[model samples]
Target: MTERVYYTSDALEMETDVVSCTRQEDGRFHVVLSATLFHPQGGGQPSDRGTINGVPLLQAIQDGHTLVHIMEGPVQPGKAHLLVDAEVRNLHTRYHSAGHIIGLAGEKFGWLGVKGNHKPGDGRIVFDALATPEPMTIEALATEIGALVQRSESRIITEAEGKRLVTWGTLKPYACGGTHVLNTAEIGDIRLIKMKEKKGQLSVQYELDA
Candidate 1:
């Protein structure tokens, strides 16, 4: 397996690495680096978009053992320095952090168990719960998350089984590989755009203020 420069479950783990890299036929970079803060897109979370050595990375994806960075301009397949856009990284990290914050409603409201729910900015977080919100005024769930944002409490990060863990205000600790902000307050007033229930799954949609 190639070196995973960035591996903690921490989503906000941002850093830059410089090392030997290669350009693929499909127009992607085969990167072998010392260390990387950029996360390869996977697990339903969209791939990250940024630049490598000043060349814009079309996107990043994990292909088995290889972390590929698809780009536009030509790239050199040797040691090259790299930099990541802080803004892009932060946005992705914030969404990831918000995802966990949003899960609080289910965990607090009570859930039997939930699975297959991805981070926010992609879709809804749905799982088994003692109760799902009613069709009308389901927005209360979003309001609950808003309250957390209002509290602006710092979220603590830990490590378990090689994955970064985040915990907030008695909410269930979650294991994830994406980047995240330092605190729940950084989520910054997200708005739940929609809510739906289909085939016994509760789905809530939320977006950060732009």
Candidate 2:
């Protein structure tokens, strides 16, 4: 299993040991590191992009408890340098934090979040509701979310139970494992782009200002 450095720190780069490298049938090398700063594609957030041993990493995915770093070039079993793309990391962090903000807004507006997608260009949260509730307009949601972002009180906290929680101001603590900004202020402006209801699910789509 790879030590997940991303859990404790948001450092964009690190030096770690390559535990093993295996060639997959897809023609990519699956590199496992003793520790890594790479955030795998999980928890509605995308994978971190960068290089392992100076070779571009194609993707990072979780295989059971292990995080697999896929690359086009072969890496030997020894010391290696891990570098995460700063720009991509920043964008993912911002989007993920925005999702949490919107989730808080949903709770404030009596909507229960059943799922979330923090991916760039297609970020959204799906809520479970019995009926299409009023005040579901994009304008109303944007207004509420904007207020939360303006407060700039979001912070990450670790509980005695060992769960990492992200709290925005006085709202309820949300358990999340993905990377995020230090505060809601870093999320900047958010725009509600779409909202739809299907099969008793309310999907609220949003995007961050460039």
Candidate 3:
């Protein structure tokens, strides 16, 4: 299994051994590394974009405990260097962290967060009303999330039962595996785009200010 560097560290560049590189039927090479800084496309987050040994990466996917990297070019099985795209990483991290704030706000309002998609430009949190939640307007929820953001609280990451739990300030901790910013202030201004309730689920869509 490739060590998931993105899970525990914020390192953007690193050198590791290339375990294997094989051409697939699609004509792209599947590369495996001893360790990886690239976050694979999963858990509602997109794959990390970057280059490995100068070969452009097409996508990274999770294959059980290991991550398989698809690249546009061939990579020899040997020592290799990886460089993760800082811009893409920052955008995803900020959006993911902000999504947590939305979840925190929803929870405070008696809405239980059941699902979320933290993809940039199309992020949202889905909540299920186990019981009829306290009446909450879209504006009120947005204001609550904004207030949480303005607090500029630091993010805390810890492990429990081998699962990673992410918390913002003293609120509830979420079992998350994606990358995130160190602090809520780094998320910038969060704009609630839309909120709708259907089939006993409330979906709140949001984005960050450019």
Candidate 4:
């Protein structure tokens, strides 16, 4: 199995041995490394884009226990360097961290966060109401989340099952595999786009101020 370096360290560059590199029918190459700082496309987050051995990386996909990195060309199966696009990584992490803050605020309003989509321009969090929420508005929820974001620092802890538990400051922890900011303060201004409730579920769409 490929060791996921992003799980512990958010470093944008690293070096690792290339276990294998094979050409696919589409002319692209599938490269496997000993470990990866590239976060694969999963868990409501997009795949990381960068260069491996100077070759443009397309994306990283999980094939069972191993991560197969798709690249524009092949590099020799040996020690290789990786450089992740900082802008992309930072934007994705901001969306992910913001989602968690929103979830926390929702919980305080009698909603249990159940699902999320942290993709750019389409960020959202879905929740299930446990008890009738004391009349809350989008502005109020945004204010609540903003308060937490200001003082929230992210912490990653490992469990026996090897799952990464992410927590912001003293708030609750969540089992997540996506990249996140070191602190919620880096998430920037969160703007609630829209909120809708249907079929006993509440979906809140949000965006970040550029």
Candidate 5:
């Protein structure tokens, strides 16, 4: 398994040994490193865009316990340097943290969070409110979430059991594996753009002006 350095530190670059390099059918090389700072595409967050040993990193994905970094050029099986795009990482971190805040807001309004997406420019959180006693408007939700953001009191807490939790202010924690900003204040000016209901599910779309 690749030691995921991003989980502990926000370092965008690292030097690690290339464990294996296999050429795929698509002609891209699947490179596995002993440790990596790249966050793979999972849990609604997109993959990190960067480079390995100066070669463009096309994609990063998890294969069981190991992370395979797809590269445009072949990387030799040896020590290599890994670097991630700071802007992309920052954008993803802020959006993912915002998702957690939106989830807390949903819970406050008696909505049950069922799904979420943290893709930049297209972030949203879905909730099931089949038993909700009252209708939730975008304005009300924005007010609630905006309040939390204004508090700027979010943190990433890891429990003894190794469960990663994202907490927004004093709200309850939500288990998450995606990258996030150190504080909710970094997610500036959140806007609830659209809300839709279908088949007992509420899709609340949002955007961040950072």
Candidate 6:
């Protein structure tokens, strides 16, 4: 049987024991713990950066349904301290919120397949669609996402509920296991970084303020 994953609901520092860890066939280290604040990689969000008993975390990918933190170095389980790269996580959180704003805009504009996109680099996101949008003006996309982030709408819904909000015809609701800002406004200054067509698909990229 696979091990059970543990996590915390709050972001504050709290000690958690590393219960167990082992090597997998795919070369990624599998870890389990009494609790963790580190968010696993999923939903277009990269894994949390951190260390385990002095070992550096490279990335995280979900193992079936469990949250695993992939690390480099020796790690023995049993009450190991938990640490998280809060600065990186903060940026990821902003990117995630920005992704949602794009989803909302896609819906308002009758675009489909807008969710389920995350470009891995510098907190960028891509809103994909089966059909290309008429080349949008930067200010137009910015005003849509920026206003939402500025509004900072406060709503914490479950996976089922979140999916319900961004439902587009024939498009599945995205389900990601990453930490997100409480409101849209937390994702400030999202710019439309790109738009491209490949094999008839149009992808819209979001730019993060440096």
Badly placed stretches (over 4 Å) of model 5 are 130-133
What is the C-alpha RMSD, rounded to one decimal, of candidate 2?
1.8
Model 3 pairs in collision = none
Instruction: Give per-model TM-scores.
Output: 0.78, 0.93, 0.96, 0.94, 0.94, 0.74
> Measured by TM-score, how close is model 2 to the native structure?
0.93
Question: Mind sharing the TM-score for model 1?
Answer: 0.78
Give the Å error, residue 115, model 1.
5.3
Worst 10 residues of 6 by lDDT: 164-173
lDDT, candidate 6, 1-210, per-residue tens: 222232215463446677677887776676766667777777677677877766778876667766667767547876576667778778877777667677766655445543455543544444455344555555676676666666656745344543423222322334555566665666677777675556644467775763
Better of 1 and 5 by TM-score: 5
Each prediction's total of clashing residue pairs, residues at least 3 apart in sequence or on different chains, is: 12, 0, 0, 0, 0, 5
Candidate 1 residue-wise lDDT at 73: 67
lDDT of each: 0.63, 0.86, 0.89, 0.89, 0.86, 0.61
RMSD of 6: 5.0
Number of clashing pairs, model 5?
A: 0
Model 4 lDDT per residue over 1-210, tens place = 888899889799999999999999999999999999999998889899999999999999988888999999997899999999999999998999889999999999899899999998999999998868766689899999889888857655556577678887688888898888877888988999999989988999999964
**Cα-lDDT of candidate 5:** 0.86
Model 5 lDDT tens row, 68-178: 998999999999999999998899888888888888888877888778888988998999874653667899999998888888785756755677766755668877778
Residue 61, candidate 3: Cα error in Å is 0.9
RMSD of candidates 1 onward, in order: 3.7, 1.8, 1.1, 1.5, 1.5, 5.0
| Model 3 poorest ten-residue lDDT run | 129-138
